[model samples]
Target: MVVQDRRGGGTVAVAMACGTGLAVGLLTSGCSPDGAAADDQEPAGRAAPAAAEVRDSADALVRAGSAAVRTSMETASGGTRVAIRGTGGYDFATSTGRLRVVLPDPAGRPSGGHQPITEILAPGALFMKNRGAGVPADKWVRVATASLADGNLVTGGATDPLAAAELLRGAREVTYQGEEWLDGVRVRHYRGTTDIGAAAAAASPRTAPALAAAGDGFTTGEVPFDAYLDEAGRLRKVRQWFRFANGAPKGASVTSTTELSGFGTKVAVQLPDERDIYAGKIASPTP
Candidate 1:
């Protein structure tokens, strides 16, 4: 297995450990509510129709064909916090995308500015370049998505754009949180908790395995999320909260946010050949 050396004071390592299926320290946190009022609640106290619409957000993306994506992942542990951000585009029809992820320098360490890592996100596999710590900068590291506990959701530093929307397939207890203006576009906001197991069972065939892996990887089954959808029911923005054990008495918290825009944009991604992938042992990052 190739372990990409992640910078940022061990934050990435801790997050990746949760996906390794290893018995490491655990991190735990409460699922607190975010204050938001429903502009229009369901009639007779029944489930809102918006709930059903939220479940189909992923399908809406597939119809859109492609879009630009921005991702932000923040992990908090032991009084330290680190963030990873990425920008890219995804071709939903082909289930492939590419991102340039920027990693921060380790906290309190001398700054020798780090390079952005290029990541290729495809079905059941993740390819990364500029994987530091002795690996050739030109070589890509390939990791099977099914082999990951978190299904490469948190491990790759940024969650796969389409996978993030597919997660809504299991959305429950959904409440319409009114409409808001985002990036000059009007969007309806919804809040809810999604069951990973349920999502795995309902997700598209190509995405089921990854969600299944995540259902078994994380300590908690319920993931709370806030989603913003356009009038056309396309996913405009989403924020999901996750907790994983990191070998700590009290585990850490991770907040992953993904933003989508420029629907129907052109996204071209090329996969690396087998020979270009690194085959040697990957040196782990120093603590």
Candidate 2:
């Protein structure tokens, strides 16, 4: 009987561990409050593109900066992941967000018929549902962090008005490091960072305190990045290195990708509506 009791306890322990892992995975994978990360993963592909525009020392910073923004905003047909590192150190836990926009075609066909576009964000809320109007598909979309928190961090997912008022602008410079293949295609990589304090401060004074808790102190630090583009001149992959703000990379590579090509082809738009939004659950244990 003693041995049986021990065995039962061990089983229960294992079950608990597995359940906890699943929950953590769901949260860390960038699907916590928003429908951003968990579902709709690109069905893995072969590799990233091999032909991205390389940065030369003589390249103009203005154009380079604009290109960096435009390139980062590039979207794939199935979807693109827009992500950035949060430098404002925080105490509770550092956070980042990945917004997936189901790209709609000019024809405005069924949402499911086109590819999707995805963008990752620093810790905060994303309210594209309201501000997306009249915004060109290629135009860089900016939003505020506070507006993103629909009171229900989980159910409301990620959407808030005024989040886009804060936009990301050109960097001082964009220097290409080299090139490598992700998934399979060859891509050009560049590293850079922009001051988060000013950007966040402009958006809200609480930015500093919130970022401090995340370990990315409110002051300023370089936001490391790796951008990959394919032969067709489309951004294929990007890896950001702000651990708290930008989650750690898989390995040596800052970001990774396995697929490329086509959008608006079998895409679908089924975003959760605002009424379905909420900051916390009815029966909640979240903080």
| Model number with the top TM-score | 1
lDDT of 1 at 23: 17
> Model 2 RMSD to the real structure?
16.5
Model 1 TM-score, all chains together: 0.86
**For each candidate, what is the lDDT?**
0.77, 0.27
TM-score per candidate: 0.86, 0.33
Q: Report the lDDT of model 1 for residue 259.
A: 96
Q: Which candidate ranks first by lDDT, i.e. highest? A: 1
Could you give candidate 2's per-residue lDDT for residues 1-287 as a string of tens digits?
Answer: 00001222221100001101101111122311111212222224625211113221112111122111111111111122222111111111112333443322323222334334343333443333221223333333333334321111111212111121111112223344566776566765544443334334433332333322222421124334344445443444443322122122421111211122231222222334445333321221222
lDDT (10s digit) by residue, model 1, range 29-95 = 4433456535566445534386798899999999999999999876554444456788999999999
The reply for model 2, stretches above 4 Å from the true place, is 1-145, 148-169, 197-221, 243-266, 273-275, 278-287
Cα-lDDT of candidate 1 = 0.77
